[model samples]
Target: MKLAFPALSVALAALAGAHALRIESSEVAPPADIRGEHQELERVWSVFSAEPLEKLHLAVPGPVFVRYDSSLRPVVTPEAAPTRGSAAGSQDDDESVEVSAGSAAGAVKEAGSLGSEVKEAGSLGSDAKEAGSLDEAAQEAGSFEAGSFESDLLANVTSHSRRLRAHKKTQDDDKEDDESDAPEVLVARVVVTGNSSELLNMLELLALKKSSNNGLRFHLQNADATAEGFLLTQVQLAEQHVLRHLTTSLSSVVDVAPRVLVTNSSETKVKLAVQGASGLLVNEPEAITLRDLDVEISGSGFVQLNVSSVQLDGKLNVNLAGSGAIALHTPSINASEIKSSISGAGALVVEAENLTATEIVTAVYGVGVGSLRATTRGAAHKQKITIAGAGNVYAGSVVANRTKVEIWGSGEAYVQVKEKLDVSTAFSGNVFYVGDAPEDVRTSGYFFWRTPVQPAAEDKYETHAAIASPAVYPEHVSVQTKQARHSVDPIVKKISVGAQSVVLSSHLAAVAHGPNALLVFGCVAFGLVAVGMFAQSFQQRRARRHYRPLV
Candidate 1:
């Protein structure tokens, strides 16, 4: 009875092993047809592979979202290598290249002989050009004597220009057609959800699999049973560094638009260097290091920017082309010295309602408009504001101690001065201020408009007009503000991907298979019988040892 129980257990264990092999062999690999539109990743992985992936590079031709989450565990699968047949084929190719080396050397010698012949031909052509010049001189003398030289010269010039234009037109058309025929790489949206340690590992993986050819696809998602996270491939960076500098821009060729969001969840201070994409929204960080803030606006190119608590230590450059609008909102600004140069059809709004600065220097060029709503408390606080284009500087709400204003174009400056005000106006440029005009006023072709009474609260500064143009805005800009007003938080959906296969506990299906299954069962039975016989012989020896020892 004891032997029978042992045999039964061994048979059952073999059947269970076969059943697991069937389950693993039957599941399908993940699909590759992931779209460019944004999709959120599932938070958890139910049955994950134990393969540890260090890093991931996503090279999909679309926007990618990378966020930090502490709840997820690290689960990855190692990439499968190519088969032995492909490796053998590569070796054969190397041998064939070595065999062709002798033939390639012979071709090189023939090319050298051809180059010597071409040099001889070039010398003969130069001699023929000299003879042709002598004939042309004789022809020119004859035409001068015939008194129709000017008319003939004009006709030749006209014909030559027509031929050049036709050739240029053909070349332009060919260039356009070549550009049109080029393939458009599909933009893929990839979201990576992991903590800082896993994120660093992903960076390492991208470094290993870097290549010029865009053939391979890499994904960074928790390994789920259904494999819903992997949709597109990733790109590689040269080296690992702190995730500080980031650029978000729309591709001229790819149809997918660019959108970026950077939010600091930890209490630690973070620095950001942003290449201002149109729809960029950044939350307020404690200490920020921003340099060369450049935005190019063309066509319907409009950008809405809101950054708070700025300490001006770096350069801020804003350029506008084709009537594109930019509304920059800064709530508080602290600067030791401020210098601003605005040109083109750009508009700038510095909402420095609580601005503390010792010196503010501003120069406006082109039809650029600027509005500064600042309050300077100290007596040493001074402003040097200059306008050269048809632009306007509406600083009527700026209460400065001493102000210097210069206008060269049809520009205007509205100021609120405390003690001394210096104004210089040329052409139609004018300075409109409340309070008596100080003695240091110079006007060359225009007159100053000084209001007798202080302006009303509503009429302190002119309202901006660029904000109303093409109001289709970014989601982050709208969502953040709306939620703040209503005191309502946004809801996040937690999705768990379910397993696609049936869970089978019974091993009968594995054991009922053909000859291989029966053979495995027979082996298990034989092993159990051998172990039982060994145990029976050991018991008989022990019984004899106990009786003989007593005698």
Candidate 2:
């Protein structure tokens, strides 16, 4: 029993050392461009923005796609009124009033000039006026009274002139309001034919400005001042079964409604951001570079991104809070570092080279599964994974130099190690690895066990990076499996050889708590006692057979 104590403690310490790894600088910088820069493209834009006519012409170097923007409602214009004649009559009335006002102003000016001349003459002849009779002075006084009447008339003329100007301004303002109330006419219909392309080619030579890539992209939006807010109806096409080589096909709908259609000229890559329950399909035969992008999916939204190689700015963030699905597969991802977390029922599958992350978390609230196929070049590029709930991470295909893992619940992690693996487990959580065992380990748990087994068969859906695509999982299916079986391939693999007979077969230990721990220790003690008794009985039988009665 004392010997068993030393053996048990040594085994627990080894299990602790088996699981040990860490990641540095786990923060990912936010993307700078979500909805790419907006710029107008020449020639192609006229087809969407020009006034509706019976005929329309357009051309492009590549294939063209046209779609109606359902988010934009038709603009309803008010009926034209019979206000042309009334406006003309008001202008005529204003002109007549102006003429009469001008005549009254001229009479007032002439009367003022005569009054000034008389005052100057009266002042000049002061000596003569003294010699003159009082009668002459009385005549001059009468002329002064006449000048006062002219001054009052001038005031009345000025008042009349001001009234006429106010009336004219009021008429002009009413005319302007009438015109403004009239609605504007936007593109209502378009017709594209073979000749349209020829016309576009000719226009490009004549008026088109030299652009970087000259690649054109069309945008359909609302004609109202506020271009965003309404929901866009998306029509999904049939799924393609072709693998490795995939293509995107889009259909268009045309309607006689007022909408704004703008065009953008792309130079290198397209920056895209998708929100709500939207589906995004990205298929590029050549390498694709992305910077500053964000995507959020709710409900049944999904994203299928396949590229040859991808270059990230500084950070890439993807959140699947609902049952949404995301499949990001690429040959290589170039970046300083990356991090990811899954907290919903959704599934995320990723495959790339040298995939380093601070920690891949499967939160307590999460019921999803994550599959990662990555390779680290050096020990400094080690990865970390944490399983806190029922969420599982199948990283058996990942060949890492070092990995650090933590299991806080019943969740399990399958990893492939090249150098070292550090683990800490609580509750019923377990850690499984297939590679060289660690030389030293320590654990805080009471009981620990390690088993060796031959590698399981490869999964049919397994690729270089993922066990299976998220698409394979049916909608609303439970992420948890009934039992760990190799038949599923993705979740668990069956071991062959003599190691297969073991109930718990792996390279690491299983941590049990409370009653479970007591039960396991009791079984181990009983097995040891039974073996000791059997050996003693065999020895006594041999001794009796070798010596005769007393011997």
Top lDDT model = 1
Please give the distance, in angstroms, between residue 227's alpha carbon in candidate 2 and its true position after superposition: 21
What is the TM-score of candidate 1? Answer: 0.37
Tens digit of lDDT per residue, candidate 2, span 33-109? Answer: 33122111112222121112211112111122233433332444445343554422443354343223323223323
> Candidate 2 — which residues are off by over 4 angstroms?
1-277, 290-295, 352-365, 374-380, 438-551
Candidate 1 per-residue lDDT, tens place, 1-551, comes to 01233434443443222212010111122224432232222121121111212122222112233332223333324443433433223423543432223232233232332223334444334454555543355466664333367646755775676568668867964553343233222212222332122221221111222322221222222221121232222222211222333323221111111111222222222222111122233333342333334433432234555555555443344444333355555556655565555555556566645666677676666576777665432222788887765777777766677888877656777776676777765446767765454435444323324422222334244344323222111111000001122211111112121222122232211211213322332354345445545655677789788888653
- In Å, residue 66's CA in model 2 sits off its true spot by 9.2
Q: Over the full model, what C-alpha lDDT does candidate 1 score relative to the true structure?
A: 0.39
Question: What's the true lDDT of residue 299 in model 1?
Answer: 23
Q: Backbone clashes in each candidate structure, one number apiece?
A: 11, 11
Q: For model 2, what is the error of residue 13's alpha carbon versus the real structure, in angstroms, after optimal superposition?
A: 71
Q: How far is candidate 1 from the true structure (C-alpha RMSD, Å)?
A: 36.3
